[model samples]
Target: MDEVRVFPIIITKNKDSSEYPYFVEIPDIDGMTEGKSIADAMKMAEDYIGTFSLENKLPDSNTKLPRVEEGAVVTLVSVNVSEYKRKNDNRVVKKTISIPNYLNELGKENRINFSEVMTAALKKKLSV
Candidate 1:
């Protein structure tokens, strides 16, 4: 699957309240969220989609977008699924690894953090 996904969103003025003036509709996912401003609404939409992507519940992007209505703004919001998952999935797992005794001793002498080093190396190798 592509790392990034873009979805169409509709933003409308919330006539009911002035505090959160924007109402965002994510038609693709059949979801809605409110924001105090246009920028905030867009961000909420991205976050909502990112959460859904993590759950493997995102709908096909090829689905037809809802028709634009008067006084409503239609735009696209893009999220990098891989990046989102990397940032939000923070559970850590322990592993057992073996290395040369001399290298391990040298690392200990230098007070290196093995887990941190391994994480960095893995991230670089995977380009995440």
Candidate 2:
């Protein structure tokens, strides 16, 4: 597992959005994403961090979060990229696959899991 990292964030209230009022951004990161509440913003920030490759972020003295204004808040958010990948990469996606009728029938008769078998075969073929 990669070491857990804490990213500082600035959360600004959005008067323009009644539903999702929190606007969150990571100082060490380049983009901003929004959420409905403080907690939502925190989760969104973690996910946002997860979406970027490690090359995009570097912690330095310059990463010190900006001071919060009256309607804004500053906080630290933690994300373990390896843990996030472990938790998220297992999502199963529906895929339409084709096989020879004889092969399909043989697998069906033998009671095979198409999805699991296909995933394994793909992983082997792709060297993943």
Q: TM-score, each model?
A: 0.67, 0.63
Q: Candidate 2: where are CA atoms >4 Å away?
A: 54-63, 90-105, 108-128
The pairs that clash in candidate 2 are: none
| Superposition error at 19 for model 1 (Å) | 2.1
Instruction: Give the alpha carbon lDDT tens digit for every residue of 1-128 in model 2.
Output: 47577778889999999988999977786769999989999999888887663435445323356777787888888888777766557567899988999999999999999988998999899787
Number of the top TM-score candidate = 1
The top-ranked prediction according to lDDT is 1
lDDT of 1 by residue, 34-118 (tens): 8899999999999998988777767656434668879998888888888999788867989999999999999999999999999
| Clash count, predicted structure 2 | 0
lDDT of each: 0.87, 0.80
Instruction: Score residue 122 of candidate 2 by CA lDDT.
Output: 93
Predicted structure 1, TM vs. truth: 0.67
Task: In model 2, state the lDDT of residue 114.
Answer: 90
